[model samples]
Target: MLSMAWLASALIGAFSLAVHAEQSHPAGKVHLGASERRADVTGLRPIITWPGSRPAQLGQAPSASTTAAPAPPNFNLNELMRSILFPNANVIFNVQIVDPGEKPKGPPPDIAANFSISGWGDNLYPRWDVVSYGAVGLEESAYLLMKPDRLCQNGKPVPVKREDWIKYVAELSATAKAVYTASLARDRDAVAGLADRLNESCATCHQAYRTG
Candidate 1:
């Protein structure tokens, strides 16, 4: 019904309108259909945009750098036991006989004058915080015991791979965790009661491993 020239002109006008509509919008904006625009405007759905590729998607494998933890440092088993375990165990044991909440007697020592002493002005014993530290040290000692390439005093490798050794370490860690929990509650009797269990855990390990 229409002439060829009129039909061509109508087509050109439609193309120009489409081009203008596209140009009017800001760059990087997705052109939505009428229904999508209505949904977006009504807040039914939000549009999300990222500057680059989307961050690690769910179920994606992690990068190689984040795959494994660094190796533990090599340390002597005997020194670790003496320095970290023995001293901390003593702190736990002391709690059985002494009340951690009790304040130190007399005036605090002059720190400047007695700086040479290891604990100078600080309370040397019976502190709830120290008890917690000791317990934590004992618990963490289990990990140190299992350290790769650890050696005992007599030049033999630590029996970390042995089943009995693993069991003893687990017992020590559990008792130590219990001691720490009691220490946090400031329950002196509770901590005191755990001393025997802690001692037994240590004694069992020592009997099995420390004997020459």
Candidate 2:
């Protein structure tokens, strides 16, 4: 009887451990277990510098210029701006999640979500709101600083026009704000979409704005 009791206890302990492992492995925003890391928004290490270096301020929204609005250019600033720009949010809230499904016994990683990463960020990033709102994933709101016309360090006019650039900045910043607001509302799809929009804008702008 004692042997049987020991066997049963062993099984229970093993089962408990297995359950714990599974809970840890599957769920929102896990950083430690995955073979490769994926960003909540962009799936890559986000650039987190621009402020301290005091990146040059580009021109702002143009006062109504006399130039007439021609048909939209064949190239897409919406696409580029949405891709190239990246905000320096992590500088403020550099969060990470080690596991998702499991309720951590003692403190867990910096952040975790039950359903998806956006939700995780909703809770985590907001905690840092008073500190910095940059990583808040304002749609297409991010841009690589000092990348004039995308020539960046090349010192040349970006193929894009000044007006388009300014317009995109407004669009991205506004979009990110709107999206993050939606996330705070617990709207998952919109929140995730905004993250994508932010990443896409940063990449696209970098390409067109960068010197070839």
Candidate 3:
């Protein structure tokens, strides 16, 4: 039996193809004589229109001469750093003390206990999802931080010209990914060490960028 996700994807693809077919040739008829159609597992046939015909509209809107209004920029560096990156990074960092290899210790202290993430689930992985989220956020945020036109909240631009900033951000991303990898492997020492590496990266960048 097909999963709900697969079924949803198939339905969406079919609907998209149907819309394209309707828009391309005419109201009722679809002209695929000069077009190529491909069959997939979903049993939906993709339609490709011929040259010199009206082009099919896909994800983007079909435009002739009108210019679309510019989208307002939503996020600046300070906001993103504070709102998204900081909390997520802390989640992964918090688990640094856990030693997966050691025999089960007695109940953890109230502040340090793993509650719902107790490794008693059917999959038996403890808080793997949370660790993965932090890893992905760190890796992705590095790329976003380097976006050409990103600004700080005070209207100053990110220091793209500073080589050290770039290098440190890259290091942070790499170390976060390494931490994530170790977490997935349940390697306690590796995760602990790499989390420290991530901290070093953060400190170096803050020294260069953060104002007193």
Candidate 4:
């Protein structure tokens, strides 16, 4: 009876040690009664807790979102105005030059008349290429104007408020789209009317946002 009691006590002590080992190590590790030294395990090492210096928070701060904002364009708003907006708007204006009245003179004989990229003539067909080019340029410029965090050469934000700026850009896009549709339908009068609207939209934006 004494020998049996000693055996039972030893088994209980071993079971307690096994439970203690399991609790101390990370999950998935095999706890053995007797095995090689920990250092002998080829790629295994003790789990490490993060240092007290670091915080173990889950969600990031709200202000951290600003860091993810898209980067501004390489060039400034003024450069974009000069290179893209002005040039493309001029293309539309030149359409009036090429064909002024309902009955414009046919292609200039000796280049005297101001002919535009669209062409110079009283022909029935519209200059689809010229129309498309000008319309697309204006539309794309409007899109750029609406991009976030745009600035002028002097590093100033757009002169107008964000809402107003977006409104103006949308207006410009609408005018250009109307012009494109008119051109597609070969409606010279409608195209001319829309061109005037385009000019107005541009003037409005420049008045509000153009900087020194």
Q: List the residue pairs that clash in candidate 1.
A: none
TM for candidate 1 is: 0.63
Clashes (backbone N, CA, C under 3 Å), per candidate, total: 0, 27, 0, 0
Worst 10 residues of 3 by lDDT: 115-124
Off by over 4 Å in 1: 1-73, 121-126
In angstroms, the error of model 2 at 86 is 3.3
Error of 2 at 63 (Å): 22
Residue range 60-165, candidate 4, lDDT tens digits: 3535755686777778888888898787787677666665234545863553354332332222223454565577788878868777677887798754457788
The TM-score ranking, best first, is 1, 3, 4, 2
Candidate 1 residue lDDT tens string, 50-96: 58855554445768986997665566788898889988899999987
lDDT of 3 by residue, 153-200 (tens): 779888766888789887978887787677667666777777788887
lDDT for model 2 = 0.44
lDDT of each: 0.77, 0.44, 0.67, 0.66
lDDT value, residue 116 of candidate 3: 33
Better of 1 and 3 by TM-score: 1
